[model samples]
Target: MSALAAARAARAAGRVALTVPQLLAARAAKQPEHVAVTQGSGTLDLAAWQRRTQAVAAGLRAAGIRPGDRVALVYGARDWIAYAAAYTGVLAAGAVAVPLSTRNAAAELDFMLRHSGAAAVLHGPDGVVPAVPIPLVWDPAVVAALPDAEPLPGPGPADPAQILYTSGTTGRPKGVTAVHANLTHGCRLDPPLRRLAHSRQFLHAFPIGTNAGQTMLLNALDAHAGMLATARFAAAHFARLIATHQVGSVFVVPAMAIELLHSGALAEHDTSCVRLFGSTAAALPPAIAAGLAAALPQATIVNYYTSTEAAPTQTSMVFHPDRPGALGKATGGGELRILAVDGTPCPPDTVGEVWLRAAGAARSYHDDPDATRQVFRDGWTRMGDVGRLDADGYLYLADRESDVIKSGADKVSTVAVEAALHEHPDIADAAVLGLPDPVLGSVPAAVLVAARPLTLAEMRAFLTSRLAAHEQPSRLAHVTALPRNAGGKVVKHQLRALFDRPDQEGTP
Candidate 1:
């Protein structure tokens, strides 16, 4: 059947008929020769990618994998095309794909394998598979040689498609179960190939298995652009790739953005081809945003706000000189609400819990009913962020509820303190956490990575004008780097350990 005919049939059958595998098939049918993915010196075309995935699906079926069975994918970003093919193949075989990070230690990997009850493990050449016994283990070469054929009884849109574990910054990571519909929510079947396309190449360095990485993978199939990714992110390497590929659109985290701004790599490359630059994972500080705008004058800098469990219903803001700190209003039929603790709607500029109800967001955690109920209620998901809406409905983030530091009679936002620190010329990166205080219960303390030697007195004087007395850091420590997770968020809990030692406290 033709791609258009299948799409029409699927629409008639309702939403359950459309899935990720079907989307890939549609794109491959329309643009068979288009470059689908580029990594370093390698490239994979659309038709060949589709064919390889089909072969992988056949191999999984021959290995006795069945619908709803979990298959863990272990690979790095450098082998992205092969990983994409494997991910698609798992869906095509009607099995759930669980993508594990290559950075995970043996214990972490073992826990995930046991937690998800994964039936088989598929990995790249260098991937580290856990020692836990599994029925099947297939390397890239093994699956690559399978005969090309579509597997029977593929997954429907309503079927559980993937299991993504959250970054366990606060506690043990929980698995987020996403249906095929959630995965393919915004996919475009007949995406424009000419003038309407955003760019010839979309560049990002998000590792495999992350929500951002998965979103980029879908864009590769549906956004009418080839994807360019790196195994690991280094500011200079990222800038060089953009110039080499003439990449038109790029996505990054705020940490990556800060690195690029300070590394002087932008001056070393011809980055004039970039037209769209986006930041996600966390709010981009206004200082970094302004620097990015100045460096890439032709690009539109966008800040996206969304959580792993509340994806597809995102809030985005295109940088405007007037609203430098706003995260913008909802776009593309998304919904947002700021509500008080009592569930009342907050008035304009009132800080409250941010709730979102995006179409096709994840329904629940994989097997944790208690965790699911805590965040998901009455069709709305609490974003775990404290924010306020402007009179015009633009959202301004204060901080994550878990990160707010209670200092004496006042509650201080770590984000606010960090923003103030970022404004200082010598400070490159900053993280604020609550340290135990005898008088104030918990006081706001800061750790900073500075370009030059900085003293606590200088920091206090610089922040005095910008922050209230209670909001200023009480204790300051100078460090070369701040501890960050795989997703680029500072691990505040890890920083707490620094204060536990008596010798590490106070100004350096």
Candidate 2:
């Protein structure tokens, strides 16, 4: 072959589409009639999905949405099929999608819409449209009825694709902008990799609009297996789906994982079909991982650690008996660093701020350059937590910078305390927080979900061998359950309210 011909072939290959919509189009072309996603009783096939998304795109285009326009998607977890079409349609229309969960309150929806300056909103049937000054479209059925037009040219790899709002545990949520390249990172078209090679269908209950849900959407587009999610997550029902469908792969956040183990949801069900039990949206405590492995002895229990800001760029750790609370090393152009206050790298075994960056386009806070400058520096994204790397490069997280307790002169890791607490058979679930103190500035307090009342003295005795003196909880609250966000992270900000009064457990 001539050099000119070879160069021309390379150029042609490079011009192939690289966006999410393009991935969907490829699937539609390759296996048009294959079922792609299922939510409750609804199922959408690749061919039908392509046609529906095209019609929706035409509707958005006719509604005056142009390239780079921010279109908010207010959808519920139950509307996965509709949301999938609308999301792809937004991309097909060359506009950026801003996914807002139906779980979000009126105030949250209003803030995100106004903040993104959304050109329009495509709301699901159950989704509430805040009274923002933007064009509001009806449910997915309305857009699906619109006549399909010739599909618009796919966006470039670097074109802005979506804005995901962060789960605001410490403060107000910020919109993190991800380009097409970033969204499609690790995805392929030529001989597309069959993720979860052992699974025919993968199950999850992640709420729409969360980073975890977005990854599920990507899975539906390119993964070999179809995706299934329930409208509302319940441990019994989640277990039932696995048993009934003989689901080979499953995923959940740590909160759901704990509920499954503690609630006895899997006791009556035959969950032996689960080949992959993946925990994400937060780190899985080693004890919880061990329990899950015992439940599904055949499955490979895996934990993935990632934040909304540092996604596609994450670390995964297969369940290991030796690595306690370790958030695996980076792979495939992913970078993980422990940086000191001055931004210099910390040596192995030294705790510092965790920073991570993926190979694709960097994500930034939408329309907030000042805030973006703080988190997205150079090409790395600060993880907002302090951790250390082992000589082998495994990351061991200590605590979030805000969650660390300063007991007199000692700095305490709530994660370490919580991990120790998890080992106690009496504690069903637990969270550690720093409560204000006149002398120490702040001290560690524990809120627990247990079968019966447990005293601080008992907890201290049990944890004496597991945690340091400064790390032991001085205050305790026995509650029914911990307050969690849609992403399954503990709402520590609200946990403080528990200590205000006493319950079955003695007063703090």
Candidate 3:
């Protein structure tokens, strides 16, 4: 057996229960003095972090939080340590955690608070206070004042852990309910500090409320080394942190990767310490992946594909020249398949709905049974994305099933068109959508942010070799930026609205 596989098996054999609080307690007991997480100038050792989280849990209990009650966490990225403590504290108190982004506006936050039936809110100083009728607003000071005490009994694996609200792209955001087992999947009772023995530090700039951010938090506890993160993402700042901290592993979304590549900050910093750079949230554009590989010759670039609902069922790929756009094969015991419209398996290279079944426990959307029924069926979850699997089982995503542009009779993938546009040196960002057309019923249109002026004809000429005539965009709009959500995904509905306006035309 492989050494890593053997180690994982050994660790799994020793595990009792897979719960966040138990994992934190295990790490603290095993590696009391190890630095767990660092944000800016502040750092916490495992022992201190555990004590603080327990104290926060006591505080929440004192404030009348009970088992199964939802507690909302609203914190900026810089306040991640507090956020982490509150997240664990909520779970430790046997209450469900509802992590909301500080990027959310008042109305959206209000809606989430009301929808989740949150009893209390734990917020950072800089977080926007929602106008909702939540009972308690606990901040850092309140948590600190609470006497340090052993928390209430840790929740069982089957108990609810957190409610993560999805980024509303197509419609209202749905809360994805995750159990303790779902959150703590793959955690093991192996030697606590063994995971990061060779690795220096793990770094990321994902905001506090994201799935990526929560994963990073888990890494902080379970990984072998210290964890570092920034509250706000600036490419130069992120680059500087990596150089300053000598981070060995880094995680980022594709947008952050693009910004860092263009910022020219890598040239100014000594980044030789970085060995692994990983991208998630969305597929790394093949051109961007190549650029990253060229820029960080010492590092291995990896791409991970998964959704909030179907996590731990990730498809991971280490970048290789032969598989330029492939999102590698499913790993970690997850199963992946492409299904046609008729719900049968699609042949290799045929675009169809992507479905994933996690190796661990299944998940469902909270309070939205209709949405749950639509995506989760039997043991599998529909990823709501359209893609194809290669003969070798590598995944290639086309576009979101809802975002696919229907032009005449041809179903054009917006992501494919955007990928082709991104291949052009002058285009910085791109979003493609289907616009209503009197003659064609619907025609593919593009909105782009470019480094230089571009004409529709120039774009079409460039894409002629890369795409078919029907796949080429029928109209184009130039904008300084494409609308993006907190998760860095393009809001294509907004793009469609922008392009459908009266003044906007086919030529830039």
Candidate 4:
């Protein structure tokens, strides 16, 4: 069947029908003795995990959380187990689960809590109040007094279960509303037998509140597998945990791979058990992909191209070496298209924005219809990612549409510059951004990490040979490290701000 037809069938019959609670229950029943979660020192087997979540749900219900109420979860990687329990607990109690990263700025946090109108907040490590006060469940004494109760029953598929906050890469963050049916739609696209049959354990080290972490947790629950956790991703700790848990898989951002390669930590771990290594959130540059494949030769390196608006669109497995940079073809449940600026489909090899229509695609940004309308068209979501698909159907990402550098009259992709710089042996990592220039409108600037001291002359010479004159960096700043978020994507906006400041002017 064609991809479009497959999506239609999935939407009509609900072939991907499965709920958050149901998936967890299936895993708990099928493998009661299997380890379902692991923190630094704590381990919860399937039965225990199920029971904890139910008890947490009961606790939430007893605390007056009702169906449709939004509860905010602020957490990092190590706290995933408890918060994962809370996510299902919130849903099971008929309340909507709102997951937000603890790493977000206080202003962002305040905006999310106030905008989401979250009734309760689950604080992670630091219970300290925000710079600006907001009510939260940070008082251990009060929480300690509450009794463990049974899980509450919730509404059917139509009821809201999860709300993922946007990365706010462009503007203010908006919460993406996902009902039980949405999650069910996501689970159905890939089966446990296909994705998880050979892999019984995965190391989930991403921030707990992000969509990628939620996807991993839900999948683990569906497959009845082990999840080895870490406080955050410490290269040393990650290596040790992989060895200790005999972890079979992991989801990483491209930045993480850069760190792994720089630290030479991969050689420290007994990584033979890692059967699958998947990347998402940002483009996994060809240099990093090649390095990771060489490092983990036995592992299947898959890159899933998706966004908060569209759950899971396209995925490329590293085993398919034919299309090296392809993020993968359109999946069975979505229509993937590369559209020109005018919204017309671009021909093969012509770069354009990626648009996707999928079963589990987010309904809308919670309350902002204007922002929603910008990305959500008649049905499809304009993912704001620029890429091109080969005639054979392989998609190659160039950059986020917003990340495109408008240099004077031309639009240049920063990714092209980064990719060119990554070819430099002395370069450990590179992030390209456009700094405001009175003369050029926006001049390309580069922030890079080097194995040894690197000067602009060398970098310019290297990139000048590989990149077009317009695409070459107008300024190159050698930094101790690239400015990146925990997920491993370069914080281009932050980098732009860093160099644009008056005090740092003319340093490079």
Candidate 5:
């Protein structure tokens, strides 16, 4: 059957068939030759992607994989096209896809493989192979040579589809599993609300296997424009893609934005095509957001707030000069609520725990019932963020609950402290953490990447108008740059070790 007919049959299969393969078929039917995904020098069109994934699915099953069996995919952003094929192939084969990043260490890779009990590991192109024993460990590139088997039995809305592990910002990562229903919720072929429709391409450099990267992969299969990615994220390459492709939208984390501004790439490149700039993974600090606005004068700055556990359901804020502090409000059938310690909704603008509920089946930690129970209740997931909603329902985050620091009698939000630091004339990036204090038990510490060495007295004076007396950093350390992981979050544990060393101590 032709791609169109396959899509029609897929639609006929269920009232609202939300399977990934069905979505792929549907897109091919709509625009077969459109560039679906683009990386450094690689590109895949919709028609070719559908055809390749079908063969790939057959090849995996021929290799002895089974329905509902777990298959780990270890591909990076550089291998996006191949990764896309392998990822969709696993889903088409009716097996759950457990995607791992090549950026992960061998030890980390082995842990996820053993934890998920992955039946096979598809290390396509240049994916990292864990040391664990597996029945099959093969490159998915071999799928191109295989004759297609009978079409997969097809998936249902409730069929287990994907397993994505959390970014280990705080501790060891956990496997977050979801069904097709959860993955495809709110995804429509003809989305009533269209964004960046006038542009032919959109760009990003989010790593594969990350929630952000996975979202872009889905965008390639479903969005109006082709998805553009690069092997590595450099301010110069990112701006060049926007100019070369006349890309209409861009997505990034705050770290990239800071680097883009610091590197002055936006000023050097002709990136006049972008109309929307969206930041996710973490909130964009206000200072950085303003820098982007000045640099991309025509683009509307948008901030996306979501987590691996709370995806699809998120708040997307269109930056308004009036609400610089506001992150976003819930959109797309997503419900956001801030609850006090007593489990009641906190009044608007009152700080409390954040809970998010997306529109479909809830996700759970694979084989981790206790961990699942901790975050997923009824249908809502705890965001583990301390934040508040304004009268207009805009979210303003204070800090991660785990990062809050107590100084003497007051609880200081490290995020708030860091925000103040970002506004300082000399500081380019900052991370606020808690360190031991003789009197306060714990006090705020500042790790800085400043233009010049700054004494503790200067920092305190600069923060006087912006931060509370107790919120200011009690211990300060200067570093050429803050250590960040691939996803762009400061490695806090590593940052803390600096305080123990006497040499890089706060300036006397």
Candidate 6:
């Protein structure tokens, strides 16, 4: 049988619990002595991890955490061990785990906590404690001192397991409710994730709170794998960890992969031990894809195109250097459809919205039935991505259905920041566009027609007072007139190309 057939067959195996804690319990029983999690100097075996998870559950229970309650997990990326224990403990207590991004400032953090209706929050070393109002805070020191916890009774398949938040572009972020069944049906896990479990070790580089980071943790646990923890992704130290730990896999965004390719450190490190290098969260340029393939000939460069609402929808494993725009075929996890604006299926290579459907697709966005109604339909999850599928079944991403600005790892909402900037009295009109940056990924370049002679520094100061750190513009360009087409809408694409030219100044 083919890979898709096998995935479908395994998915039909019936009623597997998909909760984070539940997966850990299953792994513990199946591979008790296997290495579960790791950092630079420490490692936790499955038994030890199970014990810690139990202890965390008990502690959470003692602190009055109940089932259906939302508990936030705010930690740095390298704290995967703590994340595993805390996440399972929350689930064991019959509560939902809502992971928080460490990069978020106090304002954004507070907003997300309140928006998610989070009753409790667990913070690692990097989180702001005073910003959250949850009753109990799960800290790293507490995790280290606590004794192992006992396994709690199962809630079966119907209980709520986790609530992953959508990328907050409009208003506040909506919680994506996921049941125990979603995990298994969403993505297929192979035996190599179990048989060569010890051989698999992940390098925690991305933000541990995002969907991508959560997927990495789930992937590692699925493989019964270990990890090398790091708080921040230093290109130098990250390369060192791969060589030292003999890490077999690493999950990086496309921008990071490109940066590593140009970092000059790829030649210095022995990265042959890395067998799987996964890239996601954005489109992979064919040229850059080829360069990475040439650099790491030993590793399989897998390109995954998905999102918070519909993840792992399509994957491209084989990269052909000759093809400029080739994203490999769809996986069994979801059905990919290129549809026209009227919801009609488009012809091959015709640009349209990439619609997806699978048994593992998210049911609805919690609390926002209207939004849930918009994105989720007759068993299909509209991925909000604009792309085309070729006759060969490979997808070619063109642009986004939503106006979310993706700069490297940062997903900035153009509407959100534009709203903030328009409030400034000195600013007459403001148009924000993403400029391609070689180092920090994508940076926002503001093209403004000020009411008077307003300096870029002055405009930035006004935004800094209101906007989050990453949302602020890295560069600002003063324009005499705003470029508008016949429709009166600003031509952001024209402004975007200005940042690409080396002729522009004030680029970071």
Task: Please give each candidate's TM-score.
Answer: 0.96, 0.95, 0.94, 0.89, 0.96, 0.75
Model 2 regions more than 4 Å off: 1-17, 502-508
**lDDT at 121, model 4:** 78
Evaluate residue 214 in candidate 2 and report its C-alpha lDDT on the 0 to 100 scale: 94
- lDDT (10s digit) by residue, model 4, range 415-447: 778878888888888888887888779878888
> Compared to the true structure, candidate 3 yields what TM-score?
0.94
- Please count the clashing residue pairs in each candidate, in the order shown: 0, 0, 3, 1, 0, 9
Q: Model 4 has how many clashing residue pairs? A: 1
RMSD to true structure for each model, in Å = 2.0, 3.2, 4.0, 5.0, 2.0, 11.4
Q: On residues 1-508, what C-alpha lDDT tens digit does candidate 3 reach at each position?
A: 3212333344578744477887788678768998888987888888888888888888888879898999999988778777877788888888999999778978889899999999999888775566877888876677667788865666777889999988888888889998987876777756534554437589888887778888888889888867898877788898999898888898999888887887777777988787889999988888888988988999989999988898757899999989988998887788899999999999999999999988887889999899899899987999999999988899999989888878787889887887788799887778888888786788788888888778778888999999999899878788887788888887878876777576665833
- CA lDDT, every prediction? 0.84, 0.85, 0.83, 0.72, 0.84, 0.68
What is candidate 5's lDDT per residue for 332-361, written digit by digit as tens? 788889999888999998999999887777
For lDDT, candidate 2 versus 4, the one ahead is: 2
Worst lDDT run of 10 residues, candidate 1, spans 188-197
Q: In model 3, which runs have C-alpha deviations exceeding 4 angstroms?
A: 1-16, 191-198, 500-508
Better of 1 and 3 by TM-score: 1
Error of 5 at 90 (Å): 0.4
True-structure Cα RMSD, model 2: 3.2
| Tens-digit lDDT track of model 6 for 1-508 | 3222323344478643345555666566667887766766667787777777788777877788887888888876556777777887777778888877676667867877887788888877765584656777766787667776556664444667777766554345668877756654543333433522424677656666667776766665666456556666556777888898887777677546655765656678998877777787765555556667787888877777666777534565566665545666667656788889898999998978888775564556877899889998887888887778888777876656555567767677664566566567565456777766777667777776666766557767787887888888877776765654211235566676666566544633
